[model samples]
Target chain A: MSTKDNPSESGRRNFFKLAAAGSLGALMASTPLKKVLAQVQDPEKPATNIADALKIPKTETSMPGKFPGKVVKVFDAQSVVEDKPVKTAAYQMLSDAMLQLTGAATLSEAWLMFVQPHEKIGLKLNPIGGKLLSSSHEVVQSVIEQLLEAGIPKENIVLWDRREFQLHEAGFTADAYPGIAITGTEKKDADGSYYNKEGKLYSEEMIDKDWFYFADVDGEYDDYTLPYMVNAGKYSYFTKILTQDLDKIINIPILKNAGSSITLCLKNLGYGVITNTGRLHAKLWGDTSAEVCCFPPVRDKVVLNVVDGLRGCYQGGPGANPQYICNYNTLLVGTDAVAVDRIGYDIVLKKRIEEGIQQEDSPRGRQFMEYAAQLGLGEADIEKIDLVEVIK
Target chain B: MKNTLILFLFLFAGNCFAQQPFVLRDDVLPDITSVNTRLFDKDGLWGYINGGADLYLEYGFEQVTVFDIKAGGIDYKADVYRMASPEAAFGIFSISRFKCQESARITPDDCLTPYQYIAAKGNFYFSISNSSGSPEAQVHLLAIAGNLLEQIENLSIEKPSLFNYEMLGPHLSGLKYISGQLGMQNGFVRWEPLFQQSKNYTAWIMPVKQDGSIFYVALVDFSDSADMETFMQKNGLTASNGLNQVVGNKIYTLFIKQNNRLVLTEGVIPESLRDYLEKF
Candidate 1:
């Protein structure tokens, strides 16, 4: 009953396409040819090893899962009280959004549509913003409660991110969620050291060597950055948690902006589950964000995207800048990562315009969403999306 | 005074070599809970900011010193970025400032929001933030900023002569300085497509609001004539056309090209700006 086993007929066709694409590509490794390849490449758009990730086929449980081109936004004025996210309000917001998204009569029914009692669920969080604008604990609690109501055991759930300490700094701890496994790809030892006795980063052990996203550009990290990036080279490996530890993924990204673009569903899951991402951001951010999810480990597992928009930054974001922080007091839920991101982008864009951050819409901001759509991930066109809004 | 200025320049240069500019002395603010500082060089910037470091690097970064201060029961984080030039520092500051509540009393190029204060002076961009935007926290934040600015004084940046006019004094807060695509995307997004074709340029934009209508005046300094020529060709601008005004559905644009610079106005252009457009 493993979710990975069964594939639809269309999935099989994609599998053959992937096998065909990887035949000659898998043989080409990091070599002197890389220098020659770099010379002819677009200096602006650097060549990435995205073909390597697409070698594996998408599965039945792939992105835009049960429902595609559908997004449900639940808003409540009382979601935050005295700057703190109210847990009860969050629970109700999520409950209503999921029911509307799935058209389910009960909360458990809506939860069961995306998960089962047997599957291991992973909640990927964005904690880069720290306490000011990180993914709220109230939303996470509401999600966990719904999963439990659907009969999934607490031990079957795990909380994870790229950095372990950052998750703790954002207030995700064992004491907070008892029996639930809390982990990250990059970890520090009990004595506050990034390296173990062997002088190798603990992050290196968490990566799956078999799975990697190969970009033509090389990343050179200094001693200070090495701990954060884990490795420096042409390869960015996928974390084992996505490859083996989790059977299903529920992406929980804070509703935030990265310049003109929104860092919603794909940006979180794309950048969160991979190592050596510090290099990809400069030239290949939009491409890596779309291509990384094409890999089977992520594409086939991410079933849901829950955006915590209760408190988010409208201007200087993807990182926390307190001046731009606003109380959105809304939760956006969708099975389609791209569609969810599109809606989230609109929300942030409207806020930015209202704040007079920018004069009008910037096409550059929507490039990532368009790229994600071109890759057949989900819907990016605003007109095609079926948005269901629930006001409480 | 000249000798003191020379000594200050020498100290500033020496400070770069020494790597520690000025440490926050505990004695200065006795009521402060704690002050922690960390330095990020070119190689280690990604460690602190992750992907957000790319835009800063694109604008030309040297290093940044971050300070974490807990005072008056509020947590504050301040970052002082040393950029390649005054323009680069101002470019970063212009894009980062949101709906500024009021101008900071320190420098003309400064914004003070409820939770953040951003300013640019010389080759340094300073950003200070607090978790709680209480009046007490803001007072402590300003004290810290004032102290930090006092340590490095008499450093100023050269600006375009157009900014010196008294007409723009009230609208100075709406000004934006941009150098690259990242800055364009963040600050002046409406002009992103027009600037996207050009390789190297610096632009300063000022927005004026009158009678509930907002319009913009922008001056772009192109690095080379070839880039300017290409820009003119792409946007249908020619010297022969003289004052070219294109009317769109929502806005009216006036394009004026001079040598390697372009002065443009959008929306309801003010008569003063239109009169000044002839001089360019």
Candidate 2:
């Protein structure tokens, strides 16, 4: 058969041509026409087929020089009452399994590595999803208790979200833990000043001056605007308080189906740093989303990524309507934000398939996962990932 | 022949429809309650008087009209002359800084600075002068009466102008008028005059405080839009969609109908007038 009719012969010729060239740089330069020829020849390793004799670089791990290992720990357990499988028992089992993965003898050792003893750890939770599809209270309180037991002072721990009123509506109270506190950026002190004003809580200030400084002087929203920054002058983007005191941040986000693809660690950080986050929604576009996500303030600041997947929201989430919540009984943790979100995209896809939903119909099912992967954020291929599961 | 006539008539009607109305209202001065009420309080120093003695006249001829004035409290002054023509009334006011000790002294160069020109005819005080360096100042103009020394304090400056007019009707209160210099970028003064209709012409006036100083006020009739547009263009103003609607092709004229009134007073231009002139 002619080489055109025999696909295997064409593949062999392309492979030898690439091999004889010795390097991808030489091959691409020598036979520019072979660029299209390389794509169809290797189906399994297409990204590698374009280049030859070059090994793909290993993914970067949290600890430098160490290969990235499985960061998630899952456990299997039976329910006490229903005599059926209980997810909460699985959570407790996974908590133990996490200690083994990290090579720590106890939970305290694991937490010590999770949060340093001297650090004032801010546990940023997502309550925007309301109670059902939010960061579980049990998981949050468990992490808070773990930090306290690991020698981080109770006063050094604060459970924070964007709005205090919403946190209260979602069932967190000031009086719940006296030493260990739960507060939002909007909390007021005894003197009635905002807790986060003038670089107090977060370092970066809100952009639009009219919302805070001008609105206060005009006495527009007298109750909310005046008492907070009444005498305080205008603050610029450089005047945020959280940047000063925070040495590290623990991002506890819920894995949810978002309108802008998977809302996980990246979206959680988007809401955390800026004051006028609604501006993001008003000017939404594909490049705008990536630009805002990769803005300097967010890209460098987030150090830990802990996604709560015990009860996932797999459809039309990041907004709490009753239809999206699913009991996946998984808790995922990784220092690589992109990796954690990559796994989140997979969970969303699997859940959609189980419900007989088309991938194209799901907003979170798009190729942004591969785009984010190509941007060096994480690995999209399941085969390249080392997933670890445990049972009790 | 009937069809041709109908077509000609139709074209003429369409041409007439394309012409827009002149003298459109632009931005309204914010209705600050206290300032508005004080401007109209007839029972107070700002009110109109029927007739009065040379009642507290410090200088000039006898027949004086008493009007109460208040900045924070009550004061009194006489109404000198209400101008018969709208074109001659004008006034200027501004807040700025004095750069040197010679800054307040009137020289040809003094007119180059916005602050010095305003100070030449009015009391200028350094609100934050270092004396060691150039200091910022806030200046106010007092209406000049015949006697330079007897002009009431800055508080009673508006008294003389307010009492001279009689109201024709309540709707006349909304007829807004302004006066300022025509061509000088750094040498313009602005004022709003109150007017009530009379039998022959629209009677309007601006107050002058003659406390040994001279200031300029001008009046222009806002009725002719073409005159206003010409004046704005000569003064280096270009047509703005906003000012074009407010003053373009509208017929207005200026006149001086008061005595001891500050000279160099030009017609009042709209605040939006600068935007039109600035394009040139």
Q: Pick the candidate with the highest DockQ.
A: 1
Question: Which candidate leads the pack in TM-score?
Answer: 1
Give the poorly placed runs of model 1, Cα more than 4 Å off: A1-44, A51-55, B1-21, B27-31, B240-242, B247-259
lDDT of 2 by residue, A63-85 (tens): 21121434564534232222122
Spell out the clash pairs found in candidate 1: A49-A214
* DockQ of candidate 2 (2 decimals): 0.01
lDDT for B23 (candidate 2): 14
Candidate 1 lDDT over B38-149, as tens digits, reads 7888888988888888889889888888888776667888888888888888889878876777785788778887788888877788898888887777776677677666
- lDDT values of the candidates? 0.80, 0.38
The most accurate candidate by lDDT is 1
lDDT digits (tens) for residues B1-280 of candidate 2 = 1111111111011112332211101111111112111111112211111011011110112111222122222121213221111121111121111122334233111111211222212221111100111112112112211121122122112222322224212212122223321111111112211121101121123322234432222333443454444544544444432232223423232322233121122234333333322221
The lDDT of model 1 is 0.80
lDDT of 1 at A45: 76
